[model samples]
Structures are given as structure tokens and as C-alpha cells.
Target chain A: MLAFIIRRLLQSMIVMFFVAMVAFLMFNYVGDPVHQMVGIDTSFKDREVLRESLGLNDPVPLQFVRFITNAAKFEFGISYQHKRSVTGLFKERLPATLELSFVAAFLSLVVGVPMGVYAGIKPDGWLSKIFMTFSLVGVSLPTFLIGILLIYIFAVTLGWLPSYGRGDVVNWGWWSTGITTWSGLKALIMPAITLGLFQLTLIMRLVRSEMLEVLRTDYIKFARARGLSDRAIYFGHALKNTLVPVITITGLQIGSIIAFAIITETVFQWPGMGLLFLQAIHNVDIPIMAAYLMLVAFFFVVINLIVDILYYVVDPRLRLDLGKANGA
Target chain B: MNKPLLSVENLRIEFPTRRGTLVAVDDISFTIDPGEILGVVGESGAGKSLTGQSIIGLLEPPGRIASGSIKLNDRRLDNLPYAQMKKIRGKEIGMIFQDPLTSLNPLYTIGRQLTETIQTHTDMTGKQAKKHAISLLEEVGIPAAAKRIDHYPYQFSGGMRQRVVIALALCVNPKLIIADEPTTALDVSIQAQIITLLKKLCADHGTAVILITHDMGVIAETADRVAVMYAGRLVEIGKVRQVVKEATHPYTKGLMSAIPSLTHRMEELTQIDGTMPRLSDIPKGCSFHPRCPECMDVCKEKQPELIDIGPTQVACWSYHDRQI
Candidate 1:
């Protein structure tokens, strides 16, 4: 198991390196970073100083080396727009995005899995058909649209929650001071639901289809022949076997959820890395963009590694040597 | 003789299709006395597995028992509510499918599966169930019974997994164990071992068995009585030895000749000429007439009713009377 985890982590590092290299090159190749850095009216001396300052004077490989080394050391330079350390801006913004994605993923699974399970068990029943139809709507409807719909329902019509913003105030300092009250939770409700809806469709469809396949497996029939109660058969044996793939898919989709938050956060104006990323992109802030891009790539790699490791935990056969160990 | 362990009569299974209702199991009837091992053999799509699954009420959608009376020791089993039928499934009649790898849950330990079955049907405590499971593992010839009970289904070899399945089937001491091609998945050598083990175990427990397979060799070695099916209907049924030597039905004779023999040498082995008709295209009269080498003019227009030929029951017009 430890070996499996270590191997997965190592594989993750390789993937991260490839993603970083590609993204860095793509960011550089898209346009002249130096030109963007120094405005059109800049002097030769200013352009040279800015180029030297940002280390754009170096070759592509050397620039990548410098970027990687500085990234590793948490020295992402200063954001041109924010006029602050790029790392500091990321550190401040990372938590809110993480918090939002985590809650959204949780809510997706909590709501979607049970609904999927219920649908699988009762495929022909009215409730199951209704849930399945509802899931289709969830899948087809965009996150931004869901956000708008939720805001309209819960914020405009019902008057039950705040429509936008993270909370009453935008706390962008050393520590977050707001977003502590019930109304704050109310304000978060729309964005969270919007974030969760997309993930919900993914998880729901995965669970439902996987569960339907599992229900047809002979083991479930064996469990049924054992005279286990319907609850035990459905949840105990069937659900556990279905979870291996469901978990892997859900885990891999965390990257997608994070990606979705870019739109979700933008829609609700939540103070997260997603909004920060949008601002950074529009203003051509290289330091902030590089830092955010690398961080997102890092997260994608880590979450996948975690999922790969979890495969061993969920099914022990993956951990054991099935006689012939490859490259032993 | 007073009350048979199970008596299934006029059992029929029909699947609804866009065209019409397709008969999967057509008017099959059989009975198992206490401690009797009745083997049901047929080629694929002959409805052997369907009959067994239907008896256990495990037949999935589209295929259902259209009209039948399944009596377990004189109690009607077919009409019972699902909740009550579930109780009777494993407690009264356990089942083992063809694939051992698939028959047991991959995620759960053998011990947990066994104990769960035991606890579900019996009043055994967890500790007692564990002890029983360990004993069952040993009884099934698994090595390291005490330690190996924690192993998952994939950890064991094919034969060992079949044994585990048998052990699970025996956990509740069910009166009838329906083993559907239990040895089919094992290698030829392991097949005998599993067959021997299942027959011995069932005999020891006096649990009646319905061993469904197409292998005549398995039937010859394990089954006391064999029922031969063709195109979803029983064509021949009798004592195994008698059926092997003197098959009254032409289809049964065709099947027997098709089984490769070490001594018999022929330039072209006698093969059943046609494929078993698809469920949708069953012949109007005798379902096997299209494939029967001895098919007669009347065989195409009239379905033969099962008639007693001495001790055996055969449904063939050729056996309607003594040879001219």
C-alpha cells in the first residue's frame, strides 16, 4: 500500500512537471511577455530593466528553470496589477477557493449519490424517473445559469438569502474577518449550490450507471440469495462494489470542479483564486498568472495521486502482487 | 415420497418483446425428493439456467414465470410475496452460478460473506458465525481455514472460489441447492474435484441439488437422474446411467453421440445439424424439430407431449411405441 502511494505520488510529480512546462511555454508563446510588461511608450532603458527584472533576458529553458526554482522556493515575484507578492495573493485567495470546492464536492456526493442509488434501485418508479429527469436538467443547465436561477429563487423571489458576494465585507488582508454569521452562510448558499450542481450531475450519473451495472453482477444475486434484506443488499454489498469507480471518477473530477469554480466564483463575485485568476488574465499579470496556473496544476496532480492511492485502499487486490510483479 | 422437497409443475417463463411474448421455459415439470441430486443438462439457450433461476425467484426483468406452481414441501413458492420469497431463497434453496469469480462479492472477505449469510437466516451471534465460517472453509478443503477466511474472492483459485460458493450455499443448511454450471468455469482436472466436493457435501447434508450444465460427463459422475432440455423444453429425463446408455429421445441420443469418445472412431463425428432456434424463432410445433436428425413430417406440425417410456419420460414421437 505504501509502495502504491509512493508510486502514485511520483507519477503525480511527473505529470505536474509536464503541465507546468507546457503552461509556462504556452503563456510565453501566446504573446511577448516583455512587450506586455513594458507599455508601448516605454524607453529602451526601461524595457531592458523590466526584461532583466523579470529574467525574460534568459533563454527559454533557463527561464523555465528559473520559474520552476522560484516557484519551488515560494518566490513568484510581484503581481503587476495588485502590486503585491504573487505568492501572497495566491495564499490569500487559495483558501476560499479550496473551501468552496471542498464544500461543493461534499454537497454533490451527499446529494447526488443517494439520489442515484435510489434511482438505480427504483428505476421504473415515479421518484426514480423524476430524479433521473432532474439529473438530466442538472447536467444540461450550465453552472452560470444554475447560479442565476438559484440567485433568483433564493435571493430575489424568496428573499431568504443574500444574492451575491462572499459575505457583508471583502476581507483581503492577513486574516479573513467576515463570513462568520448565518446570513453569511445564506450569502454563500447560492454560489455553493451553483458550484455543486455541475458536480452533482457528474457524480449522479456515475453512481447511477455504475450502480445499475453492479446490480446486475452475480455477487449481488449471491447476496440476494443469501436472503439479506433489501437495505443490506442494496447498500451493503452493491454500494460498496460500486464505490471503487465512483470514488475514482469523483476524485478525478475535483479538477473539473476547481475549473468550474472559475465561472462560479466570477458569477457570484466570490473572493477566491478563480476571480483573482480572471483579473490577472485581463490585466496581463504574468507573476500572478504563473503562480495561479502552477498551483492549479499542482492541485490537479495531487488530487489524482490521492485517487490512485485510494484505489488500493478500496480494493486491496491492487496493493498485492498477483504472482508476477512487473519490473521486480 | 410423502412430500417432495420441491415440486415444480407446468412451469412456464415468457419474455415480452415488441413482436410478441417469447417463451423461454415452456411447460417444464420436475420434482426433487429429499437428498436427490437431479441434473438438468442442455445446450446454451435451452432454458436450464432459467428454470433454476426461476425456482429461486432470481429471474430478472422481461423473463418471468408466466404460469407455474412451485411447491416447497407442499407450500406454494411461486405466489409468495417478495419479502417472504426472499426468506425462502437462501434459507430453503441456495444457488451457485457458473462463474465463481462473479458469484462472490469481490470487496468483501469470504468470512464476512459467509457470516453475513449465516446471521441473516440464523440466530447465530457474530462469534459463533465466525467459528462456523472457519469450519465451513475447512470443510470445503481450503488450506489455512483459520487465516484464509479473511481472503477476498479473487485471492482464491477458481476451484477454491467454487468451494467457497458451495460453503456459502451450505451456510444456511438449505434444503435444496441449485448449482448452475458450478464446475463449468474450472479446468477439466479441477472440475472433477469441485463436482466430487459438491456431491459429497450435498450428500453429507442430505441437501437436494439441481446441477444445471451441458456436460454429460459431469452428469454421469454426479447426477443420480438427468433431465435433457432442448429449445426451452424438457425432452428426456431419467436415471443417469440409463439415459447415457439407452437415450429414448432422438435429441438425447444426438447429444450423447456428440460427446467425444476415446474408443469410437468415425471420419466425421455426428454433430447436431442445426443451431438451437433463437427464443424468438422457436418452431411452431416441436421446438427441436428443426435440429433433430430424425425429424418426421408430423414432428413439424404436432408437439409431442412427455410420455413415459418405462422408467424414463421422453417427449419424442419416435418413442411413442415399440420399434416396428
Candidate 2:
């Protein structure tokens, strides 16, 4: 298990390195960093000094090497707009995004899995059909649209739920956030639902189809023949078998949830890394943008690593041989 | 014989299709007394497996028991509620599917499966159930039964998995077992061992068995009585020895002739022409008439009902009145 984890971590690093490289190059193409660093009023000599200090005078490749080396130490330089370390900006907003994602993941799993299992068990039942149709809608509708629709309903039409912002007088700390407050939790519901609905569809559809396929398997039939009750058959035998794939898909779906949470956070005016990213984009904060991109990449690899570990935990067959996971 | 362990009568299984209902297993009837082994032999698509599946209420949808009744211990099982039938399944009638690899869930240990079945059907405590599970594993010939009980299905060889499956079926001490080609997935040598082990287990427990397979050799060695199926119908059923020697049904004779014989040194094996018709295209009256070498004009027009012919019962026009 240790060997497998080490191998995966090494692979993740290689992938993250390429992502970091791409993110570093993106700023060089979009606009000159020199323009943001030194205004027109600054003398040409002073501008050249600034450019040289920022390593803009050096070759693009040399600058990239320097940026990569610094990024390796979690130092993506200082954000030009905020005048704070890129890493500090990320650390502050990372918790909010994590908090939002946790709620969204919670909502998605709580509502989606049971519904998926229901649809799979009763493919023709009215409730399953309704859930399936909604699942399709969840998949088809964009996150922004869902966010807007939700705000229109709860905040505008009904005037029941809060529409935007994390919370009043929010404490935006690295560990503690608006999420820690009651009003913040209430504000979280709308965006979490909006962000999670799309993922809910993915998880639901995955679980439903997998459940249907598993329901038809010989083992399930044997389980039934062995006189296991409907509860035991459906939940214990069938559900247990369906979990490995569900966990893998759900892990991959986490990337999208975080991806969608950016839009969701922006729509609700919630304070998170995604909102920070958008603001960074407007200000042409290359350090923050590059860090954001690398962070997202890092998330994908880490979550996938967790997924692989979970697959081992859930499926004994995968744990048998160290490198034969694919062959198996 | 007073109340046979299992009695299936005029059992017709069908699958709904867009065109119409397709009959998978036509009107077939048989009974098994306690401790008796009844081998059901047929070619592919002959409904042998379907018959076994129907008895255990494990028939895949949209295939269902369309007509007739299945009685276990004098209780009607054909039309029981799904919940009631579930209770009867592992307790009254156990089933072993054809593929052992697929029959056992890969995620669970063989011991867990056995104990789960035991606990579900009986009130045995976890400790007692675990002990019973190990005993069952040991009984099925798994080496290091106590230690190996914790191992998953993938750890065992194909033959060992099938043995584990057999042990699982026997865990609840079911009155009857429907073994659907239990040894078909094993090596030829291992097939004999499994068959012997199964026969001994069933005899020791006095559990009736319906061994469904296409292997006539398995039937000759294991089955007390043999039932020959063609298309969806049981064309012949009789004492194993009598059916082997004097198969009155033409299809049964065809099956017997196809078996290789070391004593005769035949230049070539006999071939029964024409394939078993698909469910959608089964011929009117007798399904085997197209393939039977002794096809008669009436055989194609009218389906023959199973009738007694010496020690065997055959469903063929040739034996209607000893006309042959």
C-alpha cells in the first residue's frame, strides 16, 4: 500500500509540474507584466530596473525556470493587485471554497445517491422516472443558470432564503470563515445546491446505471436465491458492490464541483478562491492566476489519489497485486 | 414419494417481447424425492438452465413463470409474494448458477457469504455461524478452511470457487438445490471431483438436487433419473441407465449417439442435423422434428405429450403405441 501511494504521489507531481509550467506561461501571453509593474510616468531606466528586478528582462524560459522554482516552495510571488503573497491569498480563500465544496458534496450525496438507487431499483416507477428526469435536467442545465434560477425562486419570488454573500460581519480567516456562522450556513444552501446539482446528476446517473447493471449480475441473483431479504439484497449485497465505481466517479466529480463552485461563489458574492481568481483575472494578477491554476491541478491529482486509495479499501480485488490494478 | 421434496408441473416460462410473448421453457413437469438427483440434459438454448432458474424463482426478466405450479414441501411456491418467496429460496430451495466466478461476489469473503446465508435462514449467532461456515468450507474440501474463510473469491481457483459456491448453497441445509451446470466451468478432471463431492453431500444431507447440464456423461455418473429437454420441452425422462441405453425420444437418442465412445472406436461421431430453433422461431408441434432423423409427418403437426414407455417416459409419436 505504501509503495502504491508513493508511486501515485510521484505521478501526481509530474502532472502538477506540467500544469504549473502552463500556468506560468499563460500570463506571458495575455499581457506584459511590465505594464502593470511600471506605469507610463516612470522613467525608462527605472522601468528597466523594475523589469530586470521582476526578471522580465531575462529570456522567457529563464523567467519560467525561476517562477517554477519559487512555485515549488509554495511562493508564487506577491499579487500585484493585493500586494500580498500569492500563497497567503490562496490560504485565506482556500478554506471558504473547501467549506462550500463540503456542503455541496453533502447535498449531492444525501439527495443523489438514494434517488439514484431508487431509480435503479424501480426503473419504471413514477418517482424514479421523476428523479431521472430531474437528474437529466440537473446535468443539462448550466451551473450559472441553476444559480440564477435558485436566487430568483428563494430570494426574489419567495423571499424566504438569503440570496447572496457569505454572512454579515464575516470573519474571513484561513481556518474560520462565514461558514462557521449560522447566517453563513443559510447563505451557503443556495450556492451549494446550484453548484452541487450538476454533480448530483453525474453521481446519480453513475450510481443508477451502475446499480442497474449490478442488479442484473449473477452474484445478486445468487444472493436473492440464497434467500437474502430485499433489504439485504438491495442494500448489503448490491449496494456494496456498486460503491467502488461510485466512489471513483464521485472523486472525479469533485474536480467539477470545485470548478462549478467558482461560478457558484461568484454568483452569490461568497468569499472563496474562485471569486479571488476572477478578481485576479481582472487586475491581471499573474501570480494569483498562476497559483489558482496550479491549485486546481493539484486538487485533481490529490482527489484522484484519494479515489485510488478508496478503491483499494472498497474492493479487495484491487488490493491483491501492487501494480496489476488495470490488468485486474 | 408421499410428498416429493419438489414438484414442478406444467411449468411454462415466457419472456415478453415487442412482437409477442416468447416461450423459453414450455410445459415441463417433474418431481424429485428426498435424496434423489435428477439430471436435466439438453443442448444450448434447450431451456435446461431456464428450467432450473424458474424453479428457484431466479429467472431473469422479462422472462417469468407464465403457467403451472412449483411446490416445495407441499407448499405452492410458483405464485408466492416476492417477500415470501425470498424466505423460501435459501431456506427451502438453494440455487447454484452456471458461472462460479460470477455467482460469488468478488468483494466478500466466502466465509461471510456462507455465514450470511446461514444467519439469514437460521437464528444462529455470529460465532456459531462462523464455525458452521468453516465446517462447510472444510466439508466442500477447501484446504485450511478456517484460515482460508477470510479470503475473497478471487483468491481461489475456478474449481475451488465452485466448491465454495456449493458450500454456500448447502449452508442453510436447504431441502432441495438447483445446481445449474455446477461443474461446466471447471477443468475436466476437476469436474469429476466436484460431481462426486456434490453427490456425496446431497446424499449425506438427503437434499434433493436438479443437476442441469448438457453433459450426458455427468448425468450417467451422477443422476438417478435423467430428463432430456429439446427446445423448451422435456422430451424424455427416465431412469439414468434406461435412458442411456434405450432412449425412446429421437432427440434423446441423438444426444446419446453424440457422446464419444472409447469401446466402439467409431470413425466419426454422429451429428444431429438442424439447430434448436430460436424462441421466436420455434416450429409448430414438435420442435425436434426438423432435427430428428426419424421425423414423421404427424410429428411436425402435433406435439407429443410425455407418455410411459417401459421404464422411461417419452414425448414422441413413435412411441405412441409401440408403432416403431
Candidate 3:
């Protein structure tokens, strides 16, 4: 297990390295750096000095090595536009994004799993048809539109909730939470719902289809023959079998959820990494953008590793079998 | 007189299709007295499994009982609501499926499955259920019952898994067990052991069994009474000895002769001339007429009903004229 983790970390490091290199190359080649770094007001001589200092004079290969080494230590130079440590900027914003994503993921699971199970058990039932239709809308409708609609209903019409921004968050020292206060929770609801709605359907559909497949298996028929109650047959026998695949899809989906939260964060003006990245993009803050790219890619690798480990925990067959394959 | 543990009267199973309804089991009827092992023997698609499924109330959808009444201890089971029938399933009639490979849920421990079945039907507490489950595992011959109880279904071999399924069926101590080809997927050696175990369990508990199999040898060894089926109808019903030694119906005789035996050193194995007719294309008369060596014009013109013929009930025009 330790070897497996170590191997995953090594692979992730290689992937992150490539991601960092790509980000560095992509940003460097997009228009002149002088306007982005020092603004158009800077003198021609100043731009020359900036170019030299920034290693534009060095070979592309040498420049990539420097960027990689600095990135390895979480130092992505500095946000030239803001005159702030890019790492510090990322740190300040990460907690908010983490809090948002976690809540959204939690909400998605809580709603999706049970509903999906119900729909799967009765695919032709009216309730399931309704769920499928609703799920279709959730799948097809864009995230930004959902976000706007949520605001229009709750904030503008119903006037029951706040439309935007993280409201009065309490810093619990280790983790700041918008959920800690009422208004903060209220502020969180719209954006979190907007972010989670699509994932809810994705998970629902995944779980529903997986549950359907599992339901059709021979073991399920035997389970039914065992005189298990509809509830036990479903939740105990079939649903437990369905969980392994559902969790895998959920793990793969976490990346997309985080990706969608970028738009959601912009819509709600939730002061998180997405909002920070947006500002960085407008100013062409190459350091911040590069840092964001490497970090997000790293998150994907780490999350995948966690999901792999989770597969072991959920299934004993995999534990005993994968032990031999992984030699750990 | 003691009531038959299970009784099915004119049990006709049908499957609705785009082409119209297909009759799978056509007006088949049988009874299982308490502690009796009624061996149902037939070729593939002879509806042996379908009859068992109908009894167990687990027939696949699109297929349902069209005209029949299944009574367990005089309680009508044919048209009981699904929820009520589900309640009756593990409690009243245990079921063992064909392939033990996929019978037990791989996710759960064998012990948990056994205990869950026990709890589902009986009023056993968790600890008592666990104890009983371990005992069941031991009874089924799983070594180190206590330790093996916590093991998943995959850990056990195929024979061992079938044994576990038997134990699982025995958990609630139902009056009847519908074991559809329980030994079909087993090795020849292991098959003997399982049959022996089943026979012993029935003798001990007075649990009636409807053992559905294509193997005549299994029926001869394990079954007290044998019902030979052809094209969804019972062609003969008699004592195992009578049916195996001297079958009256042409289909039963053909079935008996087809079994390869060490005593017979024949150059070519005896085989029935033709296949069982498809449900849609069942001939006007007896389904076995096309395949029977004794096929007559009367056999091809009218279906035969089970008629008394000495030690056996034979459904053939050839025997219909014979007095007991």
C-alpha cells in the first residue's frame, strides 16, 4: 500500500511537471510579456530590463527548468500585477474553494444516491420518469444559466436568500467556513446549489444506470429469491454492489465539479480560487495562472490516488487481489 | 391424511412477446408430499426451471402464470401479491438456484447472508442469528465455520458455494425447497456429495424438495418420486425405481435409454430421434410423438393425459388403452 501511494505520488509529480511546463510555454507565447507584466506605460528600457530579469533572454529549456524548480517549492515567482506572492495568493483563496467544493460534493451525494436508487429500482415508474426528466434538464442546462436562475428566484423574487458573495465567514483557525454563520450559509446555498445541481444529476444517472446493471445480475436474482424485503434487497444487496462503481464515477467527476465551480464562483462572486483565476486572466498574471494550472492538475492526481485507495477499502476482493498485483 | 406440502394445479406459464404470448409451461400439474423429493427431469426449455420459479414466485417478468393455482399447505400462492409472496419465499419455501457461482452476493460475508435470511423470516436476534449462521456453515461442510463465516462468497470454491447456498436455503427451515438443477454446475464427484447432503437434509427435517434437473442419474439416486417432462408437459410420473427401471411413456423410455451406463457396452449411445418441439410449434397431439419410436396416428392427433398404468402414470396413447 505504501509503495502504491509512493508510486502514485511519483507519477503525479511527473504529470504536474508537464502541466507546469505547458502553462509556462502557453503563457509565454501569448502576446508580448511587457504589457502584461509592467503595463503599456512602462518605458522601452524598463521592458528590456523586465525581459532580462524574467529570463525571456534565456533558452526556453533553461527557463522551464527554473520555473519547475521554483514551482516544486510552491514559489511561482510573484504576481507581478498585484505585487503579491503567488503562493500566498493561492493559499488565501484555496480555503474558500475547498469549502465550496466540499459542501457541493456533500449535497450532491446526499441528494443523488437515494433518488438514484429509487429511480433505478423503478425505471418505468412515474416518479423515476419525473426524476429522469429533471435530471435531463440538469444535464443539458449550462451552469451559468442555472446560477442566474437561482439568483433570480431566491434573491430577486422570493427575497428569501442572498444572491452573491461569501457572507461573514468564521475563521475556525484551521478552516474558515461560510457555513458557520446563518447569512454565510444562506450566501453559500445559491452558489453551492448551482455548482452541485449538474453533479447531482450526473451522479444520479451514473448510480441509476449502475444500479440497473447490478440489479440485473444473477446475484440480485438470488438475493430476491432469498426472501429479502424490497428495502433490504435494494439498499443492502443491490445498492452495496452498485456503490463501488458509483464511487469511481464520483471520483472521476470531482475534477469536472471543480472546473464548473470556476464559472459558479464568478457568477456568485464567491471570493475563491475561480474568482482569483479570473482576475489573473484579465491582467495576464502568468505566475498566478501557471500556479493555478499546476495546482489543479496536482489536485486531480491526488484525488485519483485517494479514489484508488477508497476502492480497496470498499471491496475486500480488490484488497486481497490488488495486493498481489501491486505487491504491497 | 397429511396435505401435500406444495400443490400446483394446471400451472400454465406464459411470456408476452411482440409475436403474441408464448406458452412456456402448458397446464402442468404436480404435488410434493411432505418430506418428498419430487425430481423433475426434462431437456432444456422443458420448463422444469420455470415450474420451480413459478412455485418460488420468482418467475422472470413478461412471463407469468396464466391459468393455475399453486397452493402451499392449502394457502393459495399462485396469485398472492408480490409483497406477501416475498414474505412467504424464504420463510415457507426455500430456493436454491442453478449456478452457485452467482447465487450469493459477493459483497457480503456468507455468514451475514445466512443470518440476514434467518432474521428476515424468523424472530432471531443478531447474536442468535450469527450463531445459527455459523452452525449452518458448519452443517454445509465449510471448514472452520466461525472463521469462514466472515469470508466473502468468492473465497469459497464452486462446490463449497453451492453448499453455502444449500445452507442459506436451510437457514429459515422452510417446509419446501425449490432447488432448480442444484448439482448441474458441479463436478461428478461433488455432485454425489451434494445430492447425498440434500437427501439427508430432507430426511432429517421433513423438508420437501422439488429437484429440477436434466440428469436422470441424479433423480434415480436422490428423488423419491420422479416426474418426467416433455415440451412443458408431464409425460410420466412414478416411483424413481419404476420410472428408471421400466418407463411406460415413450418419452420417459427414450429418456431412460439415453443415459450412458457402464453396464451397456454399446457401439453408439442411444438417443431420442428428434428434439423437443418449440412452444410455438407444438404438434396437435403429444409433444413427444415426433421423437417417439412408438409414434402412431392417434399419438399425433390428440394430446395424451396422465393415465394409470400399473406402477406408473403414463401420458401416451399407447398406454391410454391399457387398464391398470
Which ten contiguous residues of candidate 3 chain B have the minimum total lDDT? Answer: B315-324
Candidate 3, residues A89-150, lDDT tens digits: the string is: 88778889988988898899999998999999999999999999999999999999999998
lDDT of 1 by residue, A1-328 (tens): 5555666678877887886787677557767766765568999898888878877777889888877787779788877787788888877777678777887898999999999898888778999888878888998998889888888888899988877776753455655523565666676777878888877877888888888999999899888887889988899988887888888888877887886689999888888999999998898877777777778888888888777767767786765662235433
How well does candidate 3 score on lDDT at residue A187? 93
Candidate 1, DockQ to 2 decimals?
0.69
Query: Clash totals for all models, in order?
Result: 0, 0, 0
Candidate 2 lDDT over B1-324, as tens digits, reads 276888899999999999999998999999998889999998888899888888877777899999999898788988888878888888889998888989999988888888899999899999999999999999999999999999999999999999999999989888899999988888999999999999999999989999999899999999999999888999999999999998788888888899999899999899798788999999887888888888899988999998887788889988899632
Interface RMSD over true interface Cα atoms for each candidate:
0.9, 0.8, 1.0
Better of 2 and 3 by DockQ: 2
Q: In model 1, where do residues sit more than 4 Å from their true spots? A: A17-66, A168-180, A321-328, B263-268, B289-301, B318-324
The TM-score ranking, best first, is 2, 3, 1
Evaluate every candidate with DockQ and list the scores.
0.69, 0.82, 0.74
Chain A only: TM-score per candidate = 0.91, 0.92, 0.92
> What is the TM-score of each candidate's chain B when compared with the real chain B?
0.97, 0.97, 0.97
lDDT of predicted model 1: 0.85
Cα DockQ of the candidate 3 complex: 0.74
Q: Flag clash pairs in model 3.
A: none
Candidate 1 per-residue C-alpha lDDT over B58-127 given as tens digits, one digit per residue, 9 for 90 to 100: 8888888899799999999888899899999889999998999899988889999999999999999999
